[model samples]
Target: MGDCTAQCLHRRAPTEGGAIVEDFTIIHDEGILEVLWRPGIGIGPGELDVLANTITHFPRWHASPVLVHLNLVRHITPPARKMLVAYHHAGPIGLTGSDPVDRVLAAFIAQSRSRTRYFTESAEARAWLSLIGVTAGRPVPAPAR
Candidate 1:
C-alpha cells in the first residue's frame, strides 16, 4: 500500500460479497496498464489487505494519483480511513451514502481534500479525478496543490 516499483493490472472483477475474490496483477499481461477493482459494497481489513497487496504491485497508481470510486461502498472504519490517508494518493475518492462516513471519515475527507492537495467530489467523482490528473487510459501521478 505504501510504495513499490511496478505497474498494476486487473481484469474485470466478479464478486460474491462476504469477501472479494478478484484477480489483481501488475505489468503481467500485454498492456495491462491500469487495474481497477470494484469490490463489494463494504470494506474490511481482509479486503483492504487484498487491495493493498494488489496495488503494491503497481507502485505507479498505488502511490500515484488514482481515482477510487466508492460510490457503491459507504461504511468505513478508522483504520481504513487511516490507510487511505497514509497509503493511497487519490484524486477524488468517490463517497456516497445516507450518513455512513461517520465523524472520523468526514474529517479525513475534509482534511484530505483541504490539506493533502487532494479532491473530494460530492457530485462527480470520476470527473474530479480527471480534472485533477487521472485520464481514461493512463496512470496519473500525484497531483500538486
Candidate 2:
C-alpha cells in the first residue's frame, strides 16, 4: 500500500460556559497514529472518550500502531486512568514523554498492556513501534514525505 498521511486537531469544551478547552492532534502516517496532547491540559474521562472515538474512526485503526506524545500533559484523572487501562487497541502502542510525571503515568498504562512501552524520546518510540510491527507480521513502511 502507498503511504498515507493525515493530521487532525480535536477541540472540546471541558466545562460549561466555554471556560476550559482541551485539544489534541492525531497524525496518521504510514501505518502508525501519533497523538499529540496539548500542554497543561487535564486529561479526564471526556478527553479519553474523544481519543477513543477518534481512533475508532481511523481507516486502519484496528491494525495501526500508535505513538502517544505525553510530555506536556498536566495530569490524568483517576477515571481517565482507569479508562485507559481498559482501552483496547489491536496493535502495539508506544508512549513518549520526558517528564517524571509523564513517565509515571505512561508506566501505569504500559504495564496494563502487553503491547505498550514508554520511551523518553519519540524517535525511540517510533523505532520500537516499527520493530513491533515487523515482528507482528505487519511491516510498517517508511514515510514518503
Candidate 3:
C-alpha cells in the first residue's frame, strides 16, 4: 500500500441512546478511501446521512475511489438502502462483502451505477479500485505483497 492515513468518524448511532460511537473508519491511501463499518451494526438513514456528510467534507474526496466493506452488517433499513443507491461519488466505488445478503445488497447498488462492483474479498476490491483509479488518472498504488 502507498503512504496512507486513516480517520474514524465517531458519529452517534441513532439507536444507541445518544452515545457517541464509531460507525465507520475511513482510510485514505494514495487516491482511495477505504471505509470499514462496525460489524453487526444496523444501518439506517441517520447513519447514511452522517456518512455522506463525512465523505463530502473529506479532503480530496471528490478525486478518490471508494472501497466500502459491508460484511457482517446486521441490517440496512429500506430508507438507508435507497439513500445508498442515490449517493453520488465523483470516483468509482468498490464494495466488498462475504455474506449472501451482502452480495445481494451489493448487486442492487452496483446495478444503479456504472462504476461500481461487488467483491467477496477486500483485496480484490482494492485491486479493482486501484485499476479504476489508474484508468481515471488518479494512479492509486497497488498493495504490497
Candidate 4:
C-alpha cells in the first residue's frame, strides 16, 4: 500500500440548515461522491442514519461513484457493515486508508461488490476509479524530493 497524502483528497465542510456539522463531510467532485471519514469514529446504525440523511438531502448524488477514505474511522459495527453491504449503491467504489483492518474490510466488501478497490494512497485509488469509468478529482502531485 502506497502512503500518498495528496491534496486532491479534502474533507468537505458539513453543513445542516446553517451550522457546521463535524461528524463527516460528503463531497461531490469530478463525478464521484467522496466520503471523507474523520478518524476515531465508529460507524454504527446512527452513523448510517446520518449517511442516509445526507444522501437523501443530496438526491443528485444517488448512483455516483464513492471514494471512501476510512483513515479516520475506528471501526465499522457489524450492523453498520451489513447495512453498508445492503444499501451501498452498485457503482464504482474506491477505499483508501491507513488501518490494516480497513483494508481487510474493504477486501471483504469487494468480494461481493464489484468495482471496489483498496489503496493506501488516495491518488492511486482515484486513478483506479478513473479506469473504471468514474471521473475522479485531479490528484495533487507529490512534492519535489
Candidate 5:
C-alpha cells in the first residue's frame, strides 16, 4: 500500500537480525509479504520479533497473505519453534519449497488457529493468496545469493 508494487519498491534496509534477517529477504506488494529464506539458519527470538514487526508495519499486513519460501531452510531452532507457537497469529499463510524441515515447521505452527497451505511451486502459492483476497503481485523473484 505504501511504495511497494509488483516490482516491490518498498525495501527495508538490511539489518542484523530481524524479520528480514541476514539469511532472508522480504518483499511486499499489494498486501502480500513474500519471505525468501536461506537454508540452515535457525530462526529465534530476534527473527520472530522481526516478523511481528513487519506484519504490523502496515495496517493491511494483519489481513494480508504471507508467502513463505522455505525451499532452502533446513532447520528451525527449538526456541524459534516455541516462539512460532506463541506468536504466529497470521492466517491464510502459503508456504512453498520442498524443504522437509519447512514442511514440518509449517505443520507444527498451523496446529490451532493458523490457516496454512503448502506448495511445491511459487505460482500456486500466489494463486491461493489471490483467491484469499491477498493481492497477487508479480511472481516473487529468487533472492540474490
Candidate 6:
C-alpha cells in the first residue's frame, strides 16, 4: 500500500496592543503605577521610548522609587528586556505573567525575591503592595508640615 499520512496545522492568536496610547504612571506618594499594555500587545524596541515618552504626557512618570503594576504580559522578547529597563525607577518591578519566560528572565525574576514582590493575579499584586504600606489607584495626601 502507498504511504498515507495526515498533516495538521496550527494558528497563533494576534497580539493585543496597537498605535493607541499605553497607560502607565508612577505616582510618588500614591505608590502605585498603573500600566496599560496597549499600542501593541507585546513589547518591542520602540515601545520603550514610546512609554518613557509618555512621561511628557504626565508628570507623575518621572517619580523615583516607583512600583509599577504590570498586567497581562503574555510574551516578552529581547527587545522587551531593553524597554523594561527604561523603568529604572525600581527593580523587582511588579508584573503580571501568564506566559513563561526564558532562563535568564526567570533568573532575574528570582532576584526580585529580595527587592520586589510578585503575584500571578493583579488583585493579589495590589494587595501585596498595600500590605507593605504601598497604595495603588488611590490619591496621595499632601505632605505634612
**C-alpha local distance difference test of each model:** 0.44, 0.79, 0.76, 0.67, 0.67, 0.43
Q: Which of candidates 3 and 6 reaches a greater lDDT?
A: 3
Question: In model 4, where do residues sit more than 4 Å from their true spots?
Answer: 1-21, 111-114, 134-145
- Write one digit per residue (lDDT tens) for candidate 5, span 1-145: 3433454323243555545524555677655778766556566667667767655665567767888877677677778777766654444788887767667877766663667788989999988887775333435557899
Query: What local lDDT does model 2 show for residue 54?
Result: 75
Model 3 lDDT per residue over 59-113, tens place: 7788689998888677888888787778666678999898899988787677554
List CA RMSD, all candidates. 9.2, 6.7, 5.8, 9.5, 9.9, 14.2
Q: Stretches of candidate 6 above 4 Å error?
A: 1-31, 64-71, 83-87, 90-92, 99-115, 131-145
For model 2, the local distance difference test gives 0.79
Model 6 alpha-carbon miss at residue 64, Å: 6.5
Lowest-lDDT window of 10 residues in candidate 4? 1-10
lDDT of 1 by residue, 53-112 (tens): 665565354324344434345555677666655653543344333234433344565455
TM-score of each: 0.44, 0.80, 0.79, 0.69, 0.69, 0.48
C-alpha-based local distance difference test score of model 5 = 0.67
Cα lDDT of candidate 4 equals 0.67
Alpha carbon deviation, residue 116, candidate 4 (Å): 1.3
Which residue pairs does candidate 3 place in steric collision? Answer: none
Top-TM-score candidate index: 2
User: Which stretch of 10 consecutive residues in model 3 shows the poorest summed lDDT?
Assistant: 1-10
Q: Write model 2 residue lDDT over 67-102, tens digit each, in one string.
A: 998888899998888888887677899999987898
Model 5 lDDT, residue 27, Cα:
75
Q: List the residue pairs that clash in candidate 4.
A: 39-72
- Tens digits of per-residue lDDT for model 4, 1-145: 1132332333234455776445666766666667776657777888878776775544455556778888888888888777767664656788887778888778656765446778899888877776664433345557898
